[model samples]
Target chain A: MRDDVPLAATAAGGTRGDEECCTLATGPLDAADAQRLSEAFKALSDPTRLRLLAHVADQGCASVCACDLTELMGISQPTVSHHMKKLVEAGLVTREQRGRWAHYSVVPAAFAELRAFLDLR
Target chain B: MRDDVPLAATAAGGTRGDEECCTLATGPLDAADAQRLSEAFKALSDPTRLRLLAHVADQGCASVCACDLTELMGISQPTVSHHMKKLVEAGLVTREQRGRWAHYSVVPAAFAELRAFLDLR
Candidate 1:
């Protein structure tokens, strides 16, 4: 009922847990892959996360400073950090620490994997 | 942490409720659209939902019978119904009640909209 719960918290899998199910044209999505895939989608399940991702992608280069994310997202530093942590855990974004600030970037391979998995093309 | 909660349940928007954020190459996703888009992805965030969707898509026809879904999914009729309700609410699938059976089909436009929204293609 609490809508603010991030996707990281949402895609926590069933009591059946690690069991896999279903087949696509490619093949069945096993439990491990499905679990990981769901987590990635869950990361994108939030508006803030989507914006955060856009901000990173909007950077267009390899990465952007963590400090820059706070300004771009128009959110408090801690809030941005929270969402970025979830995104990083989901593997949607990669973080690199430089000097004192962490830099974040979109992982094209993650997006590409999702695209293929969804067969959105 | 209960992963069984559907994406419709997951993308319930923030307490800020119905506010929009972030821009893609196309434009910023409004709160309503972000909510809707997130719901679609949330639906996909589950392996069960993904499998259900695949079964429907595998039908290759415009629709599949609700009764048929119960068999294909290998879940109980009620469990299938529960997930189907969430999918319906998400606008990912369409249901038509015919006689005593409800025939379900994937909404191409919903997937198309998500594809464009995510820039997944």
Candidate 2:
């Protein structure tokens, strides 16, 4: 049995023929999009990371500094850095360096895309 | 340092007083809710499982049969069964057995809750 199905060439939930299906409910998710979504989900699979994300997101448009995260989370600089790195790599959040510290903000589009997928209606 | 945060009594993105905050944007995510959200995300971390979810979701309220999934995914019956189990455990999908076949349907509320967290705006 060919259990190892080949990844679909089309982007995840991309135009499948004439139908304009984007979310999971609209149609089958392509392999490429699945890979991308899975990575983002993986980044959010950890409790600590989720908390950190919540803290950063709580700040709204205001970016949270790495130094502040160290105190808020009561974790070491490296621990916060590690989690922040994962969040940034997953495209869930954006990172910017301002002076001596790195600031992070939620990428609204990313969450919206994920929310759209779950919105079955 | 108390890096290991104790789980909060409130639900994920639940009320923090009269403030009426119900999402990641409003306030910090408690450990209890973080663990729940992380587990749900863990279920979506697999590409194969995600594809399966999309397929099930595509069916909408109609529901998808396990036998059909085996053929649709081009994977073994056992493999499909395994993945389905995880989705079911994660509360991403609901399963019902009819006759000799197992049917699966997406859980809208579960996805809605997860989507709310990502809805930073």
lDDT of 1 by residue, A3-112 (tens): 34421232213322221211234334656777787788888888777767766665443466666667655688789889999999988777877677777766656766
Candidate 2 local lDDT, A33-75, one digit each (tens):
8999899999999999999998877765556777778898899
- Which candidate's TM-score is highest? 2
Question: Interface Cα RMSD for all candidates?
Answer: 15.6, 10.0
Instruction: Assess candidate 1 and give its TM-score to the true structure.
Output: 0.73
After the best TM-score superposition of candidate 1, give how far the Cα of residue A36 lies from its true spot, in angstroms: 2.7
For model 2, what is the alpha-carbon lDDT of residue A5? 35
**Model 2 segments more than 4 A misplaced:** A1-25, B1-26
Q: Per-residue alpha-carbon lDDT of model 1 for B26-101, expressed as tens digits?
A: 4455567667777778877776766677666554334666666677566887888888888898887778776776
For candidate 2, the chain B TM-score comes to 0.79
